[model samples]
Target: MIVTKNEAPANISKAIGQENVTPAWARAVTSFPPSDRILSTILTRQAERYGERILLVAGEARWTFAQTAAIAAASAQALIDAGIKPGDRVALMCSNRPEFLQVYLGCAWLGAIAVPINTALRGFQLSHIFRNSRPALLVVEAQFASAIESVEAGVELPPRTWIIGAAAGASDARLSAVALPARGAAAPAGAVRPGDTVAILYTSGTTGPAKGVCCPQAQLFWWGIYSARALGIREGDVLFTTLPLFHTNALNAFYQALLNGCTYVLESKFSASGFWAAARRHDATVGYLLGAMASMLLAQPQSAEDSTHRLRVALGGGVPPQIHGPFRERFGVPLVDGYGSTETNFVFAGRIPPDRPGTMGYLADGIEARIVDENDSALPDGEAGELVLRAGEPFAFATGYFGMPEKTVEAWRNLWFHSGDRVVRDPGGHYRFIDRMKDSIRRRGENVSSWEVEQTIQSHPAVAACAIYPLPSELGEDEVAAAILLEPGQSLDPVDVIRHCEGQIAYFAIPRYVRILSQMPLTENGKIKKGVLRDAGVTADTWDREAAGVKVRR
Candidate 1:
């Protein structure tokens, strides 16, 4: 149904306890002029207001607001020394570390576009990103230098490479490589506007290669404002997250800390066994968790350390509803559910003690939502339809998909960004998520492109045809499954199929269950009927990789 912020239901108004009133946080942040919404300006303002306060912690490295601002200036100077200019793309491939943020803030300081690549990507996927972004220089961690070298023949890489934590013999002879340069003299911040593009983050594609989403400066500014409000962040709060810096969730956490005057703690990665201990060690008050994280934590043996941490709440997007209460009862922390995307801001959120258990809460103040049919006509409140959105503030959402004009036009058709998720708006104005309308599978917090997986599997010589689809996973997410119709005279084992895909695709994209069929279900045309195969799910005769004790590593 077409629902604007003004047309919100009375029940939702009462549930949220605000009733058309602007939230204090939103009012305070929006009161500033548009010029103040850029990242460089935000950094300066925060440093001025919270000088000497610890702002970031990664491993043993810590930087205060003032120190971070100085580092940003130095980083900007370093990029300029390396021949980077405003609007140039600088690719960065690194894990969760201090340098990731250093380069990100430096890009904002110099008006360059930072392109953060997923470290898990390899082969064709990595090559596609290098070709699409066309970075001027690549700043890569030492361990990942080989991945760039592997794809050197397929695409044109940047002119120079700066290796972090340089190791002997890690440099490639074909490219101009050097150890990461020392900090340059401090440089002045560039004059950037709120509408300027600051980053291009690539998300998994449904029918084609991954597309880079062009995020404007004001969009991330609003991300910090809205996410902080949703998580109930307060000054002096310790924000902790184990999510990788390549994705929006972790990046948003950094802004949440920056805008809220909190301290952000970054860990290298997530481990269910060490989660609580890490939280306790950091004295974290606010935490972040994505798909399957909470379930994995619950699966750990009960311990006294669960309730010992100081974590009051966590931003638990994509967490299962069944474990919400159980987790809170055991850990003394609440998991707030919310909805957002790489191209969108924090659009919907619930309160600490959510009124409804599983539904995505009412729309935020500066956004409008619509539940529409295939023809873009509004549906009834109870009927399910595709959820589309529009932001009220100027430059508050991503401009478009980078270098893909047709995809951008198709996604933003009719002046609204189309979300490919099917949802239903209840009479009381709560929206519940249904299955995805797009052909994508989400596994362990990563979006696995079924089209890409199918392309990789079909490259095998013995495979005549293949279909990839999602199977119900016990951890409240989808698992990849493949159905293959082999060549008439050839026989193949499922393990061999996985072996062929080892370095070609991501480990998570490899199918867990495989089935071989003599004939395949077909549509009226010649295309395979993936819906029929998805309905059949994992059969008793399917070859199970985990059952066979086969493991795929990064």
Candidate 2:
């Protein structure tokens, strides 16, 4: 029953196409009927059909579908025994480990909500999530437990709490031991329905502040269907993920593979050097990547061993337009870029196709995506406008942000959710991302897109990384400013950087000033904190501007 690329089951594509289906772009347009089922439905199906097949791998431990389900059920019973009721939130603060999935499925099995916290968050950021989620319990690894304990002291929480892998240490005694029940009567025989809230995944805190985006179980299922088809994840597909599970990219991708009954491999942390080794070890046919991760990998010296891995697809988000062709050429794998957020799951995903540089594929089936002006009027194709998505089919649409009615209302305004990201639809109906609402520069009656500027600057050999934002000008308005990171041993002259931009970018779009930085400030999810950079003010002291050929012109 090995489900290889050539031997995929006949019903695989059909089952995935049950939703709002579009044949043109190859995707499901709508969500299926609400099911009174947990994520375990996929697990149980695997155990019944593909028995004894490995479902999960972490470190040296391997778990079959049956064993994994049993552990999940047992853990669910443990939560119920510890007074966790249905809909109660439980935060999972652990790295990429077997226990993370075990605890996540355990929560789903019991109809409780699982909030996976980013492990990279510490201090204030961690406290904000703890307070926002207000989880009744926390299932944390021993290493992060201490950080949780320190944060827990000040934050107000639910009456009960629990931590995994830690028996009882003097650090946080209030965290009681909830002994996992041994194969107890299977979760009272009920399941979390499609519309019921399943989890509260927080948004990347790049703009203002992080707000919890509510997602339901059904959304997961629908997106899982789309993802499985788009990425071609099959029953025996070995999928590897090193991205933090807290992000929607990892969570959806991981669950999509699980729903496909694919073998999943988890790494505690991502390492550029060891990535290929791990993929080869697991025989991974598919994996996940972020644009930043891809850029980092491409920066490393190439080796003959690069193309030897079994990875056929790397489904991910944020693959920059400039690097798309080069990355695919170097890696020999098609990079399928998907567009989504915590509030709305995978609205549009680029499916598996021959290498097409800089395209994020056509709009996903059943999804009604459009570019609209500030007045909410639809703009003509190729005009930059705010991206809006209407749920063409039912899947996991959020109940709304937790306790933030104003924010929720604003987000879901005009019967269309404002994505805050700008985009343009091409002649063939393909969408190209422009810049975030906050990142687009308004200068001298002209709109300058930062993405276009960054792409141009990135073409330079010494430009390793770059961020473009609006800077205050003497004209009483803001103009484009650039911050760049240089390659090792490479020195940059500001004039040369500006001159390079003049040739590639439009006159108005070219940066008025170029700032060289040791590194760009990044969010936990690796997106640049452009707002922070703007607030800090791009001053001469912050950038290394060699005084040669630099000039100020009106």
Candidate 3:
């Protein structure tokens, strides 16, 4: 079932039209029904078909399709016993462990909502999600207790906290007698419909707190199908991921393999140094990369072992334009990068032929897309504007933002989901992603909210106001930078500001470059003129902590 170079085009063409697909590909796509695409039924069906096939690998533990399904079923039963009903939210805070999937799929089985919290969040960032989602139960791991414990006092904790694999002598008493229910426990009989809201995934907001994107069970099913087709995923492909489970990249990767009857491998976390070694060990045929992974892997000394792995098609985004070719050449594989966000499904598909180095593939099937001006007027080909899209087919995108009706309405305005991204469409029909119109900062593959960072830095009484934006990083991606205005007769220290921010937000989100300005430039509408600051760039006065050799640890 391995897709050869000749056969790839057939698969690609079947998913998207032949004229629209990437120039060269080896896999073929098969169509699935548009409805009844429930996550539980899809997974359960995979188990029934694949049976003893090695389905999931985490560390040294190898789980067959049946074993993984059993764990998911048992976990669902445990939640039911704990008083979880359909639509009840269960917050899951963990890294890239297999238990993450156990709880996630378990929630899908029962039609409950799984709220995946970013493990890096603390204080206000973490508190906001808890207060907003207000889950009845929390299924967390041993390591993430500190982050959850940092939640503000007023933010109510989940009524019941169940720890997964607590280390011996762990201080939290919740883990003393509790264990994830055994795998033999029977899952209750329930109808899993495609439109059931299985999860509430939070993404950094432009204006306020993080907004939860309410994704239906069908979205996950379609994500896998679309991603597999785009990536040219083949039978026997050992798909691997180091990305955290909280992110859709990993979750969708799991589904990609599950639906295709391929084996999946999950590492504890993404490690640039050991990434290839892990892939080699697992005989990975396909995998994912993000942020500096392409750059970092290419930065490693060129070796004879570069092309030794089973990896053929590596599917991911954020592969820098400069290194995109170099990476493919060095690794002897095709690297497919595309544009996607939590709220929207994969819009521009994955493959970008070498000739079109920067274009995020053509507009996907069943998606109505446009590049529009500020007034929502459609722009002509080759003109840049806000990228807006809507599902031409049912259940292709998220239903709405959980508990944020106003934000949802604003986003879905004029019958299109405003992507808050600037893009251009060529006459040939390929879409090239431009700058982000939203103020949300993407650092190290993490969405760092400018508003969240501003509020944290504004906590310092000396700071009158702050404007956060992305600055170019040595690693190709954007780095967090803040332009600050101090109070009259007051001063601020970059080191102190960074130190204070260490626990308040993720380490990656802390501003690496700090600039002191007399006043933040404002627009005619009295909004912070971020474009003015972004254009200003890092001035001579900007202080760089990396340049000063100051390291802040988690």
Candidate 1, residues 161-199, lDDT tens digits: the string is 888877433545656777778887988999899999999
Candidate with maximal TM-score:
1
Evaluated at residue 50, the lDDT of candidate 1 is 88
lDDT, residue 465, candidate 2: 94
- Per-prediction TM-score to the true structure, in the order listed: 0.96, 0.74, 0.92
The 10-residue segment with the lowest total lDDT in model 2: 1-10
Off by over 4 Å in 1: 6-31, 167-172
Comparing 1 and 3 on lDDT, the stronger one:
1
Ranking by TM-score: 1, 3, 2
How does model 1 score by TM-score?
0.96
Model 3 TM-score relative to the real fold: 0.92
State the lDDT of candidate 3 residue by residue for 369-450, as single tens digits. 8789999988988789998887765676899999999999999999889999898877767778888888788877888898
Q: List the residue pairs that clash in candidate 3.
A: 8-25, 8-26, 8-27, 11-28, 11-29
Q: Candidate 2 lDDT, tens digit per residue, 316-388?
A: 5666556667777888887887777777767665645534445555565556776889987888877888888
